[model samples]
Target: MNAPFGARGTALVLPQPYLLFLGDTTEPGFAKTAFGLRDWAGDKCVGEFALPGATVTTHLARMTPAQAYAEGARGLVIGVANPGGMIPPAWRKSLVEALEAGLDIVSGMHVRLGDIPELAEAAALLGRRLIDIRVPPAEIPVANGRKRSGKRLLTVGTDCALGKKYTALGLARAFRQRGVDADFRATGQTGIMIAGGGMPMDAVVSDFEAGAAELLSPDAAPDHWDVIEGQGSLMHPAFAAVSLGLLHGSQPDVFVVCHEPGRTEMLGTAGYKLTSVEEVVELTILLGRRTNKAIRCGGFSYNTSALGAEAAIALMARESDRLGLPVADPMRGGAAFDALVASCLA
Candidate 1:
């Protein structure tokens, strides 16, 4: 398939074309990279390559590494963000096969691919590059709680994989289409890969995580909108600190809460019940007020991929009316997002 034009009607271009490897799992952790790529790098994605006997997710189009290479793909991206951030042994063979075929590798896992001797040797022999996206930045200073000029909008979630980055990107796109000077401030690997620059918050030392956000959105023109991508969740058992740090560092003028419609629990944790969207919004606003007392809840981005089109639209409407705020699925195209952007920036 050909690359599609972005919102500005400009053709999308990548430094190097690649295919994403999602293996057999389409769970939230494993499938997020592919979804992010599709949303931001649509033209650059040749197709997804899955493991043998793996079931492809309904939304992603599947193709073999060879097929992708035939169509100008030069690398394979390890797209899963599994628990523990380690590559599964079952996926080793497929990765090796791709290396043997001269495809470079890119991964965001905590386990660096170049650290594996065999994989390193294969890449060296094939003269291919192995990019590990989770590597910590060289020098991240502490945050001083300094103020910035532009209007900042942050997307915080009730849990990981709840589409914070997607929501941020969607709003940035919407703002741009409306002739607003909006920039997406990515804070994770997948988001960095798409935006071409961002600190990987999880890899940074705890003290510097918030500092990274402070540096990312340094004073821009007052007309600019810095749509900062959030990481983790305030209520998540595993990564709450990181989430709080980002919230405090961004000090957004407005924040949006993102949630999945059918989710009942925090991912990767047992017995942790999911909080209602209203509760999550209130908690985020309360926390954000420590940095900016005037911080407000702009809207919500509800993930309704599991539902039919009609059902999703109906659900969005009901939530919007009940919460008295705009609601939308970032992946589903609609004018609701336009309203959300306006409300947040106004």
Candidate 2:
């Protein structure tokens, strides 16, 4: 397989047929890595392994590490985005089992798996590899604010787990269906793994976060659209800086606001009420215009997973009517995403 370009223009080629480990945190943020791998890697995803008590997503079968190894899993992927990227102690046994089975381990967490004594010893004894995708490039240049040709559409969110990457990818696919040349610029670990290229924005130093976005979506023809994946929310106290840097770096011509309907509070932060969709749209436009004054809101990508079929439909209709913009659950392959692409093209 051809190597995907890394953040620093280095080549990155992972072993094939990976076993994605989604332990406990099956929420969108953590489960996203598995979804991305399934979508992009296809046959390369041999199996998925989850903790015994963890709630698994629909259509994903949970396998043991030994079973995964027997079924042709060349590597074990720690796909969850746990806080601090630390591997939970309960997961060590499974990881150790995979290591003993001679499977290389790849993780996108901030915590390096190689630093853990037991796991490190197992890998050393077994001669298996440990790769951490979150490590920043050795060097990243600061943004120069240079203008580029091409229509750029960025997906900003009300919070971190709001589906910005999915929306961006869905819009890119819809644009391709319409015979438009478009590219999805991934900005996180899940997206990078899916797209096979892109910088993990949150892993970069503050000075070069935007610079990474700029590099991801370089100059293209005016008709081409760079569907850039956005990072965190402006209101998310912990991740707001990364979001702001991505906005300033992308310098998009148009942007889409993404939110999870009926999500009362921010993920992992109780009592923190989500901002109104309208408020988020306004904020995205306000921040986007700081780099490009002509920036406008293209539409909205709504995550209706928390709602049932009827409720999701009703909320979609209401949000569409209320916002007077196209709204879609991008993961569901809804026609509304086509409208969103049309809005961006307009």
Q: How well does each candidate superpose onto the true structure, as a TM-score?
A: 0.78, 0.80
* TM-score for candidate 2: 0.80
**What lDDT does each candidate get?**
0.79, 0.79
lDDT string for model 1 (254-321, tens) is: 99999999899899998798888889888988888887778999998988889999999999998999
Candidate 2 structure quality by residue, lDDT tens digits, 1-346: 2223543473233555788887776576567677778886666777788776777552455677778788888888877777666788988888998888868888888789889999999999989998776765556778888888988899998988778988888888788778888877777777766665567788888888878777777778889888889988988878899999999889999888889876778877757788887888788788888778899998888898887877787778777888899888887655676677778788
User: lDDT score, residue 287, model 2?
Assistant: 81
RMSD of each: 5.5, 4.0
Candidate 1: C-alpha RMSD after superposition: 5.5
Most TM-score-accurate candidate? 2
> Model 1: residues >4 Å from true position, as ranges?
1-15, 21-32, 46-75, 80-104, 122-129
lDDT, model 2: 0.79
112: Cα error in model 1, Å:
1.1
